[model samples]
Target: MTTPARQPAEQQPAGPPRPAGRLVLAGAPLGRATDASTGLAQALATAPVIAAEDTRRLHRLAADLGVDVPGRVLSFFEGNEQARVPQLISALQDGQDVLVVTDAGMPSVSDPGYRLVAAAIEAGLVVTALPGPSAVTTAIAVSGLPVDRFCFEGFLPRKPGSRRRLLAELAGERRTMVFFESPHRIAESLADLAQALGPDRPAALCRELTKTYEQVVRGSLAELRDWAAGEVRGEITLVVAGQPAGSAQVEAAELAELVSVREQAGQGRKEAIAEVAATAGVAKRLVFDAVVAAKRGG
Candidate 1:
């Protein structure tokens, strides 16, 4: 038989090599595995490499969802996330799809995927996300607070002083605020929030979200602080109502009224005047003058 002419390498129709690898940040269930989306399950099942914030928790999640993660699992947490960036990037460069997941919620929102994602972007790799349950959004949705415009504050500083300073800075933030807190410190945090943001500020404490013991408590910051004082458990998310528009334009009369209210609530005259001045974004002298004028008028 006549030998067929071999196709030149240049003329070979091998098709385009599959486009370079992808990095997918998948959101895990906040509490219930049943809340996981189909895309998340498929990613867990098929990705060649899986980087998890908690490997053991990832496995437990897989078991809960009855999905098998057949890929090589790597621990990608806060401690080692930076070290693992190069390895994960190498995998993506080698055209292997990799999935990055946290123990709960989407990766990189107060999670470990930020370093990897930023590294991938700098390295010119394809990076995408598989949206799933988020405690931030879930808490806001159930918070009954104004969500038309909001900001996620994530976790506040753990130390009381730092936390208070941060809260004071945000006291005048007009956008609705969302925060995450550990169960142990929720009460103290709430109390500090009440003190810094004002006791009558509308807020909600969403605890153990999307779980059997889920609770959403909505009230003034003071009430929530008192409620949080007794045996609060599970993951907690706090949503605080934003300062009203033009709240900074408080009239002297309004400031005086606030001082009176605080005084009625057992705050000393000086303490109440100072509190009103701070909250109303006015000067202490102005508040003191207002209180004095009101006292003379009464």
Candidate 2:
């Protein structure tokens, strides 16, 4: 009989090995403090270094979780993240388990942990995460739109022209889109979105997710734009459905009809172009070009 083949030690199944000074990115609660995971609490308690977007909020979370954060909590925010990453990397190199926590949601998802995480990974240090709740995912869940695939656009440009231009560029996006907008700008943004995307486009406006006063308004972009115009308040997350099939077939004739409809409804020429473009699932530039062409009798 042939002798049984001997397996190498590297091929043998073994118990989990200790991490080489792993970097743990912990997700903090979006609202209530009770949402933190047990693993996150323990990591916070035992980590040798803590990097937080907001130190005060980190302290608050530690207090709420009843976890004694023995490690020094250092500020790691947008302005300082780049400069602070090297220091965090050094700590990790020194065999210190560094835990990164953000003000809310997961660190690095529209939060401040990306730089340090990227740096640690580049340094060949083991990096892991203690997953927690995220407003982006939560809002998408309640949005009632297609969630199979989606793109998270943290926020639209503040300027109307820039925002419209950006929306125009997204006209051909095939996946559902998510956006974070301040309450003050939500109305204008929705209005611009409806004009750029089309009034009939399906969408949802999610507000104050996971909070006591959470609200989700689902409807066509036009209707939501109108709704937003009327005393809307709270943190906002907007979900817009993607372009529909054969949407590109909407020609100048159909665009003219759209312009006529909205023009009669008190929409300006520019706004009409935006609305038509959005409804037709085409670019605002296309619709605007058509409108200009129609005016020039092209």
Query: Which is the leading candidate under TM-score?
Result: 1
Against the true structure, candidate 2 reaches a TM-score of 0.76
lDDT (tens digit, per residue) of candidate 2 on 1-298: 8998987668667867545688888878888888888888898888889998989988988999898889988999999999998888888887788888888888888778887888888889998989998888998888888899999989899999889878877876768999989999999999888877778999999988877898899999999988887787777889999887577445555777788789889989898887777656567777776666676774
Clashing pairs in model 1? Answer: none
Scored by CA lDDT, what does every candidate get? 0.88, 0.84
- Model 1, poorest ten-residue lDDT window? 244-253
| lDDT of model 2, residue 296 | 79
Compared with the true structure, what per-residue lDDT tens digits does model 1 show for residues 70-90?
999999999998899999999
TM-score of predicted structure 1: 0.79
How many residue pairs clash per model?
A: 0, 6
Candidate 1 lDDT: 0.88
Q: Total backbone clashes of model 2? A: 6
Candidate 2 lDDT (Cα, 0 to 1): 0.84
What RMSD does each model have against the real structure?
8.1, 11.1
